[model samples]
Target: MASSTITPASLPPAGQTSNFVDPPYIGGKFVAVNCIFLPLAVIALGVRTWTRLFVVRSFRWDDYLMIIALLLSCVLTGVTLEMLNWGLGKHMWDVPLADFMAQFPKLNLIAAIIYCAATGFTKVSVLVFYLRIFPSRNFHIAVWTIVFIAAGYSIASILANIFSCNPIAKSWDLTITTGSCMNRPVFYFANAGLGIFTDFATVAVPIPWLRRLQMPARQKVAVGVILAMGCFVGIVSCIRLGSLYTLLKSTDLTWATTDALMWCTIELNLGIFGGCVTAIRPFVRRYFPRLLGLSSGGGYTSSQSRSRKHGHPLGSIPHSDRVNFTNQDNQYTTTLTTLRGAPDNGSEEHILASHPSGHAKDADGTTGIIRTVEFDVENSSTAPQRE
Candidate 1:
């Protein structure tokens, strides 16, 4: 029997696959899971974009960048994984996914590059948003500075992933029959360190910036919660670090590294999601009906949300009640009233006396004064009777 000689066209040795790897799924649960995740993310990307277009009335460049990046990354990662699977003769869980993934480090580069590119851009967009929205210059500087550092790390990552070797091909293909390359360990270690820093910076930048927002206390905290979403970013970075060996040596690190890649994808998507959340927060207050409260049916407004605690939703003050009928003082008043009371047949003095002190009519009928000693009850007893 002829031995299956290895060639780029021929599949790798059967059952010699790595258990897990990075950036792309190899087979089994990895393939099934990614099949689900990619479609879901695609669906989410579309739904989120459309929802923002009509409901929020706008979508930012970051949104477009993130959606496009996610799509490209997902498609590349998925297609590459499928091709690798076919190359390996649909190798199953007999070996690690890393064994297969290691076969094409170039694909790894592509996957990680797209993931990092989207994430880096998303973070920068978030920092820009913070700069625009936050009142504190310190917050702006802090966020931008972190973004600057992240940008540096991202650039390092790009260069490292691309040119760490004399010729870039060596980083991906061991059988290139070409120039010698840098040690894989050295490249991966540096990658791990840089990734940790980028992930950390991505997590850290939003805090001070979000905390500095002039929103309500709860909302300020909510804004700060955006940074907390980085928990997944850190998780993926750390997990990949722990599995760095597989990321480096394994051929099919699909399941292991693909999870990491997917996490990174989600992290960037979440950042874009956070932007949408922040931008429409005020709009939510403006247009959305408060589920648990009453309104003059004019719908919710910023003032109603401000006055009422969140345990209850919003209630609007009627337009007539928003201002005082008589401007005795420059205070805001919300008392609904009717102008039903007219001059009685009593003496002009007594008829005039029926009106409250500030209720005296002006020439234009728009403004009035009241000078009456007695008044009829109206909508609420506290509300002045309408004349």
Candidate 2:
């Protein structure tokens, strides 16, 4: 084997050097974190795909976006593990300078770009999910705004990282010192700051709507917590910020950034986890119905699946109900009535049926199911009688 070309001057600065012979190889921690989280995220994604593709049977844009996020995350994981071979988690001075110069900067650059894209896609996937469920125009606008901001930040961050050094190749080549590079510390700080903002935005946007749901308070909180899993990723991002600052400021690049890199890997995996979790309600509702307070055969069924099996359009009355109304007057009156005076279970959907004059209208007509009724009046002067 050829001898390494590393020189004494090429080593990390004396201030960053340690005297310990086997200075802690923290690569195991990084590896362990990735080993644990990536598989969990992948499992979550797998369950999500099963839920959306087979159980819920309503695969859509958000699902596709999450798939992309997971793919990028896998790539990022591979890159990080590869960087470990080049002394990523050891003290800088402990590493052969030739090895450090050969690969670390280049791999770090690729990881940054991958992280941005992965996280962005994950957030947008969750936002698109909001678009699917919430018909509120204001909520849609808010979701779209966050989507654009996340996407734009990803694009901008990727561009900034790619062109951090003027001559592009200068990013990996420390020997070429003539080229101008962006203030990377400042750029990173800004990127992390904006990313945290979007994280909070994603976690907060659906809260108001969730609180307004008619479900019990406990279930609502559970749902909110599940959907807001990204907040934990945000919290991880916050913690990663400190590590990032340490790496940016320290002379010990390899050792100082290990924790930050680990957190970065974790953040992306958790983003994948969060993006896939909320959609797994169908899976839980199917296999573990008790968790959702539903019976063995009963849980959430998408309108599409219902339509396919029952042959009725979404929001339209079924054939069985249609037969009962054929003999009534052509004039039909539609009114919204509450579930009050009726049995109230923990069901998620409420059906409103039209009735005679005494029934009150719902405050929000768009919510719940609406049933139309036809009235036949035998005598105009008398009070209406039930058929």
Candidate 3:
């Protein structure tokens, strides 16, 4: 077997000394950050899954998609860490040429594919969540459009990465010496641009609907903040774009790509965090009411109070009697009259009427009133009776 070697002539140009031997290898930095972040991402997704399946019992499409995204993110992190052992995050020339050719491009290509899938699925999960909450036709159309765009971008990016080099093995095996690749930096920048666009779209699609929700000011703000959490993902994507630019411009491929990889990891994890945050609210409401300052009795919504007040002892209620009141001071009135034939056996006639006033407090601690009416009639004679 021939030993691999690099001569002085093979070194990067002047002012690119960082591509050669340098002190302070930073491969461990990727490992350390992944250790801290990957677990947190998994924990966030786990809590969300538990909350959806058990606490709320309303697990839907979004939850499953998010789980897929989490699994992909796990794969991405594992691949990224594996690459560190193969000379990622070091000066390029410091790596044995054979090891570099054998590992970096192949692992990077796999990571990029996983990255696109994970990000695309995450956006789908968020948009699916929005579809569940907002039923307007326009909102549904908008969300589906974005989902399609994300899917398209993911497919395009994966194909671009896979075919970036001819005789695909040449992508990783530089010694092949007879193949060509696409303009990699241009392809990377385009991919990053698409990622940033999708991130912004994911955050933007819900803002108008959030603003129109009829809720107390504090509740509105809380909902807005949660929905807007994707903004952090967008910010990280922008930073990742800058890192990609740096990686493209520098001859220190390993060192320059380190920042890009780090930012990508952060962006994906933050996206997972953002997706889980909304679903975890119910769990928080149940287990940590004080954390959100919610009353143990329940929220201030009138529907909840009405259900509590009028629900049957046998857990049945006349659906026809349901009322929705938008104004606290608004008064509603309903009357029921009933006629009955004489009972088979002699019995006394009876009539019962009840009026109840219910109080519901707003999230801001202001109180409101709800009124209820009930009536019951019993027949008394052995023979039939006519009005």
Candidate 4:
């Protein structure tokens, strides 16, 4: 429900194409839906905290910043809507207690400023985060450049938010007595252009550089897909810009503003999603345990591994040719069932079945006890040894 005080003011005079715009929209679905997704995003973030703990993790800082920005933006939007709800009750409820907020005036645009700040701040934060994660010199310059441009534009937007209405309250849930905002379309257009371009820079900055990395075709595709995932958010940004126009042009803006808010919220939230997805190597392993294979990177202390093995369901792990056993303290041991680089025949099995005393510790921490599981990459898994 809208405020009674805001009803006549929220609308443009009949037969006129012009309208008095509220800085931030209230009593719309935009605020409601965004409130719901915020928590889920934060929860997704919490579950991924494990990656940060592993000493050999490959996570990045931008991942954390992106998550934080999403949460902050979500909360700020929620708070702004709550404020609108307060206004609605004050102006329309039977015995509302929020008249103080309604009467204080100037709060609409202030709320608008808060929402705008959250919007811009979230975008810029995500941009810097993307820049941080990618590997390129241009990525650095691009992040800083966009930081100055987008952040500076937000300041301009805040100024516009402040001066849009003469008495300020006029900028928010308007009344018939209120003075209308200044050149709303032009203001929106400038800000919209700045915002759209900033999103483009943010979304595009990493593509060229990522394209140049000398990786395997499969790995390059994986990286490309990850970086390109941001384009989905870019689409949302474009839609949000359209919504900005719908919001500016419509007087009865429940639908337009809701649509606009939804798109913008999605754009920002998707960015958060992108950030979190980048860190999903560990998360996917945690949530979908089967797909990731329950292994601790096999660096667990000997004692921890034993306890874990005892606690873990039997056969949950297939029997490897070799098994590692760790005792209390720093002692490590491996029992290998088969030797590597062996002949492709049963003879290889017999060689391991009746092996000689080839006792030796290689630099990679493997000894005669046998390292059954081998990740054949350059950084191969260490063979097991007797303590």
Candidate 5:
């Protein structure tokens, strides 16, 4: 939730002053949140980049959108830090009236815009990543719908914040007395309310699709837990919304906004962290396979082997997993369905075994009568081919 600043029009009339007492300085809490979460976000995105580019060797639109989100997040974090310098977390009485009048509101306006853009891109990136992995047509439709809604919300938020005050400069420049502003509290509340709604909606979209996948119970549970961790972002948004309400109603904005701003940092950072989790599996499988109960080769385990023998495709792998079967003619038929525009053999394991002679070999050195099932919904009832 973006913190809403009280406009000068809400202040006391001429020859009057607020009776509110200055509260204890708690700006350090804001500083601490930024220091911790921003670096965590950077590290998460950095590892995600390495995992996608070097390990998986598949970089797509989702990654690009995440990069944009990160950039905007950094900009927002920087602006927030700059806000602290002008007494952002101090009591209104403590701040120099000029700094409070000019500097803080300017940065606040900028922060609101950047927050909207960053969050919008983050949600869209997660949805796009879903598109890359899940092949269900219905799921794709849901994801695309959410993408449009998120984009629309962000655009509306940016526009509203930009023109919240007619004669835009008046948004930050309290000296311009003639200009009027939209209901600042209502705008921020609606924006944050929609943000929280979308947060839960994005997390909910994958559940039904995941349940339909034919995976072992243990693996299914593990995968679900990983994705469910995204709920933390939604929870943070709720907390931020509460803090936002407190800040908007508060007479002491600079002091009361500390928690709201801190929660905002967490929400954005956790969004980045959540979006990167599934995509970084290849990196973990490569460097820390034991952590995931995977072997050094990053191939199917014994349970997966049993599942494969039954013609059930292991559900954990992404779209990039490729399988090749060599017929007696020594021609290879790749069975794994890859996403359009992705490199063949780009993701995780190359299930194709090479042989010295002109025949396909399994990993166990079986050189003849290779069996591989083609995964296609249309051909679901077809028997596995032995070649």
Candidate 6:
């Protein structure tokens, strides 16, 4: 997507040179895409941060990494916009040779570096978030391996772009014919191919574990939808690869590379947006329960009450609230309380009430007598003791 000067051989015959060049109108498209999508991406990130810090109250490493990714994305957007002013989105012959050589290659190198950093941290953030929920040792190993590969590729891409040409300055200053440069088209294709592969791998990693969770069908589908947003990012990566092909084959560099630049921006920004989607579910479920058709009274059912009455362990019930029991006048009562938010470690605490007689049984032949009541608590750690 970088700009390049037209070689002398590309020029028209001396007598046929025209005074005016037709505009391809690429700058407007670049500006329009940035104006529309960048703010939405930023807003999504903000909502996720608020949910993690204030609602869940359990911010972790993934949140920090996403913040870094968002920051780098902002830089990428700003630099790319600046590039339009430096002869981007114009035919190479339309641009003055001095202006094209002075700004195009240097600015392109900076954009590439930022792109690698942004994408690398974004994938790492996703894997780190996965680590919090999935406890399988083998899954952990697999996620960490992907993280390492992502980091290594990002570093290598940055270094390759920085040192692509001998005497580095020669990459921008074409006057220095004594230096040589790597085959840039081959490098671009390889880097983009690896990126697309990792995108698909990340999308697939969480599916099996999510399916194994012991939750209701409705809940599982909700979780799956959030994780599957990565598939959209993968789709955009494929589109970007095609655009890169067009860019590499094009001799009218600035005019033809607009599609490539636009898709690159979209792919990275959407990565940030998709990473934020899963973290904000608590906020949606809390303030907008009706949006998902969740009942306001915490969705308790009669069977759950009966299970508590018979002294059933809380672990046997899927997605049940924390419960406490009390014994009085030869009778047992159960009190259920909801935790303020889902715990990061997926563990819950329960309190079971027992009689001093040690051999008591209910009239129905149940091993223990119990009754059920329910309430909500702001913090699981501060839940009330049995009275």
TM-score of 6: 0.76
- lDDT tens per residue, model 3, 43-137: 99998988877666566889999999999999999898888866787776566666677778789889988998898888889888888778799
Alpha-carbon lDDT of model 6: 0.72
Instruction: State each model's CA lDDT, in order.
Output: 0.50, 0.74, 0.71, 0.53, 0.73, 0.72
Candidate 6: count the clashes: 1
lDDT of 6 by residue, 188-288 (tens): 77888889888888888887887778865666677777767798898899998998888788776766666777888899988888888867776776666
Which candidate has the top score in lDDT?
Answer: 2
Model 6, C-alpha of 171: deviation from truth (Å): 2.6
Ranking by TM-score: 6, 2, 5, 3, 1, 4
Query: What is the alpha-carbon RMSD of candidate 2 to the true structure?
Result: 9.8
Which regions of candidate 4 fall more than 4 Å away from where they truly are?
Answer: 1-32, 48-50, 53-64, 83-111, 131-135, 167-170, 173-181, 216-222, 253-255, 282-387
Candidate 6: which pairs clash? Answer: 334-371
Give the TM-score (vs. native) of candidate 4.
Answer: 0.57
Q: Kindly list the per-residue Cα lDDT of model 5 for residues 54-149, writing each as its tens digit.
A: 666668999999999999999999998898877677666555566677588899889889999999999999999889768889999999998999
**Off by more than 4 A, model 6:** 1-22, 297-387
Please, what are the lDDT tens digits per residue for candidate 1 over residues 124-199? 6555555655557777677767778767776766766677566677777756776876565556556666767756
Off by over 4 Å in 5: 1-23, 216-218, 300-387
Model 4 Cα lDDT, one tens digit per residue, 1-387: 334443332333445422223433345565566766666566655644555444214345555555556656666566545544444311122213234235323433454565566556666656755664565776788778888987898888888878887766565544546566687656765676777787667767767776666654554555556567667766767777787786677644333444655565566666666655555544443445344343343211232243233221123234453332332222233332333322121010123343356643333333434434322211124444548
With a 3 Å backbone cut-off (N, CA, C), the pairs that clash in candidate 4 are: 106-169, 302-326, 334-384, 334-385, 336-370
